[model samples]
Target: MVFGFLKKRRREEIRAQPFPAEWLAIIERNVPMYARLSEADRDELLRRVLVFVDEKNFEGAGGLEMTDEVRVTIAAQACILLLRLDDDDYYPALKSIVVYPAAYTVPRKESEGGIVREDDAVHLGESWGHGAVVLSWTSARRGAADPRDGKNVILHEFAHQLDQEDGAADGTPELDRLAFYAPWARVLSEHYLALRTAARTGRKTLLDQYGATNEAEFFAVASECFFERPVQLRTRHPELYDELARYYGQDPAEGSASA
Candidate 1:
């Protein structure tokens, strides 16, 4: 109990700290969505970013150097997920962020017809259930730079973080109400199946086809489109869009309309 109290106190202090002007500049310059957020949401996001950066350790990998630019830029994007949550714990399971200068390779094993093939597979970012997120700096910057492209590595991996918080990465995060489970499952399942059918049929999709891999990836990909291409997501997949907007508590399509 004492430790918990102390940790809460420390976070309160961190939240009270004056947000650095340079950090705000970094968000303004790197995150296009920052400008689209309402003033109050912007303030909340900045506070979340402050606490997120303070709590999560960041390390450079592959001979890359970590800087305020990298940390703040990454933190801003990650914390965007926490905005408006009723009980935001700032990704309690996430302990560290490891960033490579560019895409990195990891060993992979693929089984085809009972034969397993081993090789190195390139990845832009990966979210682990064990409590770490690894990212490629180049992909992260590019995702942030062109928010409308409907791809954001930080958003994608961090959405995985949210999905894992419930001890599973099954497309459903910890919803604010138990009642949300039914619709969330129905809508996301329908969309996930649609995406799979679309992929098989080579139909164009608003969401990245990568989501068709699994429910977890579907959630992550949907989150990217939720924030980056809200208007289209709403128009093309309104049920899917409504589920995400309800879970996120942000109607990004409304923001786009007002913008």
Candidate 2:
């Protein structure tokens, strides 16, 4: 309890410090979504970013050098997910971010007919239940630069972070109340099944086909589409979009219209 209070006090101090000019310039230049946010939301996001950057340990791997630009750019995108959430701990389960210069490869194991095969798989980002997120800086930057692409590695991985907060990545994060779960499960499951059918039939989809992998992936992928392609998601999948908007406490489609 004492340690928690100290951490909270430290976070308050960090939040009180003025946001640096260079960080604002980086957000303006790298994250297009920043321009679309209302001034109040922008200020709130900046406060979250400050605490996020201060609390999380950032390390560069695969020959990349860590810098303020990399840290602030990633923090801004990650904190956008928390802008309206009632949580004060930020990502309580997250401890560090590991960034690579570009896409990196990890070992993959596949089992077919009772035989297990190991191979290398390339990835842009991954979120672990053990309090770490790995990202490729190149992909992260691209996602931030093209806010309408419906694919942001930082957002996707951080969504997984949210999903893991309750000690499980079952496509459901910690909702504000127990009452919110039924609707959330119903809507997301409907869309998940639809996406799976669409993927099997080679039909085009607004939400990423990768979401069909499972419920956890569906939530993360849906989160990416929620913020990046809000207008399209709202138009095509109103039910799915509504669930996300209710959970996130923001209407990006409305923001898009005003923008």
Best by lDDT: 2
CA lDDT of 64 in candidate 2?
96
What TM-score against the true fold does each predicted structure earn? 0.97, 0.98
lDDT, candidates in the order shown: 0.94, 0.95
Q: Which stretches of candidate 1 lie over 4 Å from their true place?
A: none
- For candidate 2, lDDT tens digit of each residue in 1-259? 9999999899889989999999999999999999889999999999999999988999999999999999999999998999999879888888999999999999999999999999999999999999899999999999999999999999999999999999999999999999999999999999999999999999999999999999999999999999999999999999999999999999999888899
Q: Where is the poorest 10-residue window by lDDT in model 1?
A: 80-89
In candidate 2, stretches whose alpha carbon ends up further than 4 angstroms from where it belongs are: none
What lDDT, from 0 to 1, does candidate 2 have? 0.95
Q: Report the alpha-carbon TM-score of model 1 versus the true structure.
A: 0.97
